[model samples]
Target: MQNLENGFIIKQVDFKDNDKILTIFTKKGKLSVIAKGAKSGKRANLLDLANYIEFQTIKSKGLDIITTISMRNSFHLSKDKSSLYIFYPLEVISKIDRVDQDESQLFDLLNFTLSNLYKNQDLYISLFNIKTLLYEGLLSDFTNCFVCLKPLEVDIQNISSMMGISHFGCDLREYNVRGYPISIDTVKLLRYIKDLDLKAPHLGFDIKETVLKEILLFSTNLLESSFDIKLLSKNYIL
Candidate 1:
């Protein structure tokens, strides 16, 4: 039987001669499918990374086999370094273990991000990072310290690269983790972004270069440290 799944191609690798293996992030979750003899054909183009595609696959004892596929959205964006930033979030999504109930939101986020990443690059990138933390139940409350459980009035000092928000002089090392010294403004920005609906317009998202860098850095740190995986797109984005 052939099952139809729509997803974004996150990674692709050469299998044997003329075959390609794709790791697609579908609404069901992450799936690996082999495209037999797809190395040089229309199927090859359809399997390109970051392309949104609907494909049919047959289950097997090993990897699923892609029987037929079609492109849904090519994104038509440049494959340059900066534009390839989607890989940062895609890589994270590909690695993390998300529940089935969360798949709908995750799939929608990737779809939206790919649609708007070209024009709203920074906003979507930051949104992806902050929202992923929220979906994964990792983002800490911005109003209080995750460590001391005390009310954090405007003096927040560090944001955990993986787990918590903290006040000044808190001992994050005691938890065997590291964090970046963050500003109240950045904290407010993150909290604000997190609360925004996925479909809401980000009309007021113009951010200072320094603060934007902080958000990116903290997000990168969070993904890397928490998952124990290095994001290939990290160097390009930062």
Candidate 2:
């Protein structure tokens, strides 16, 4: 039976001769399809990473064989920091396991993220990482201390590697992880970003370089640990 789906080509791997195996994240779900003779034919260019496409496939024993593909939108990346900004999120999304409850939201988030990266790389990257964690339900509560369960004081000194806020004198050894001493400003920035709507206008606040670094580090670590996947594109971001 033939099936038609609209989605982005998240990942691709070379197969025998001119064939390729593609991992597609569609509105419906994730699909692994083999494109027979796609490498040297008209279909080769259609399957490039981050290109949104509509494709036809035949499912056989839990695998799919691609029959035809039509490009819907092609995102061009420049040889600069902007390219790294765009590619990292794509790479991260490709590594995500499909969650039935969050697939549509994830798809929209990715589409929105890629669309906005060219306009404001830093804002979108930070927003994307924060939102991805929320969507995946990986973030711990931030309103109070994870251990004490009390409101966080201004002088609180540590952010747990488990993605929780903590106090200065908390027994870090109990958590079996080293904690980063985060400033109150960085914590506030994260909360502010997390509360903003995806379509909200660009953040008007001036984020310090130190705060930005902390956000990226915390989000990256949380995602890697939660998903059990390493992000190779992250190297480019740093």
Candidate 3:
């Protein structure tokens, strides 16, 4: 059997006496595999499924079995309160994208975002990445107007409409083409975060206070209408 390497275990489940049903997100994409006898507290010593992990596996019969599990590195983020910060990305990724899909760039975006969420920096940077990258396209860098190719000025009143984002204009009248009007800073930071590591700088920007807020409102509306983002974040905070 061939071996699969260097993947993170996104999720896991127990079966029968001690088997595990695991959902893994690898660089090769996604998979659901069974690792035999992994449930008991004793056998549980085998793998730690928290943050990011490096792993290798072999296919046996119909399922992939873990050959080895690397060190556990996500302990800081997996704690109770920390996970609340990750809700937005997890919501967007699981909802809009199909399972077993290869979105290497998107996946890297998420990995970086996860690393940054706990850094006492702006969480909106993560949200911005989610917006222009996830729903928008490979060509959509959002730093400039798609039509005029000029830097955008955020007129917050016009920001609520999709026409503001997709077509790219300072005013709603500027576009005969219909599209969403994303925020100026939202576009800038979205482009910024895509390439930069998710190590959020000590930015003075506030998501709720900036035009970015309106952009997120628009992005949220679009995702909800197009995909079931709410359905994925069903695990709510208390």
Candidate 4:
């Protein structure tokens, strides 16, 4: 039997002379599909990464076979900067396993980010990274210290390379954890983002470039340290 679904083309690889292997992130989760005769034609365009697509697939023991596919939304990322925002999330999610268990939350988060990336690039970039960590259960609680287990006020905090977060003044000689210090402003912004509704209209806030860099760096380091995998797209942002 054939199944019909809509998904975003997160990753694609040329298979042979005329086919392509596509990694589509759907509401049901990520699917590996083989698009026969899709390497160079109308179908090839629709199969491009970052494009939202609707398609029918015949399930198999191996990768699903795409029988029919069409573009749903390309998101129109006009600027190079905007394109990286699309790439970062796609790259991160594609590498992490078991994200499909979140139901449609992961799919919706990407949809929301792509749909609204143009409105505020800096805001959406930070939100997308934070939301990814949130959905994956990787973010440390913003209201409390990760090491001390005490209520953390707004202040400079240290994010250890060993995957621990703590107040800057917290001792770490015994734990042997070392990390860079982040400002109180960075803490406030992260707490604010942790509380945001990604589906709702987020009024853009003023952010200094330095603070934005700090947020992105922290997120990248957290994911890398927790998963022990480097995020290549991070090089584009910071």
Q: Quick one: how many clashes does candidate 4 have? A: 0
Q: Which ranges in model 2 have alpha carbons more than 4 Å from their true place?
A: 1-3, 60-62, 154-162, 171-173
Q: Score candidate 3 by lDDT.
A: 0.53
Residue-level lDDT of model 4, residues 1-238, one tens digit each, is 5867899988888888898888988877787888999877677677777899889988777788999887889976776666676787788778888742744888888888888877766677777777778877888777677877676665434433235457655536536655677766777788888878865755566788788887777766777677677778877766
Kindly list the per-residue Cα lDDT of model 3 for residues 44-139, writing each as its tens digit.
754445346666678677777776666545634556765665565554553455655566666566566566667532444335434435534533
lDDT of 2 by residue, 98-197 (tens): 6565388778888888877776576668778888888777765567776777777654555543556677555364575667777777778778877778
Clashes of each: 1, 0, 9, 0
Order the candidates by TM-score, highest first: 4, 1, 2, 3
Query: Would you list the C-alpha lDDT of every candidate in the order shown?
Result: 0.75, 0.76, 0.53, 0.75
Clashing pairs in 4: none
Per-candidate TM-scores read 0.88, 0.86, 0.63, 0.88
Compared with the true structure, model 1 gives a TM-score of 0.88
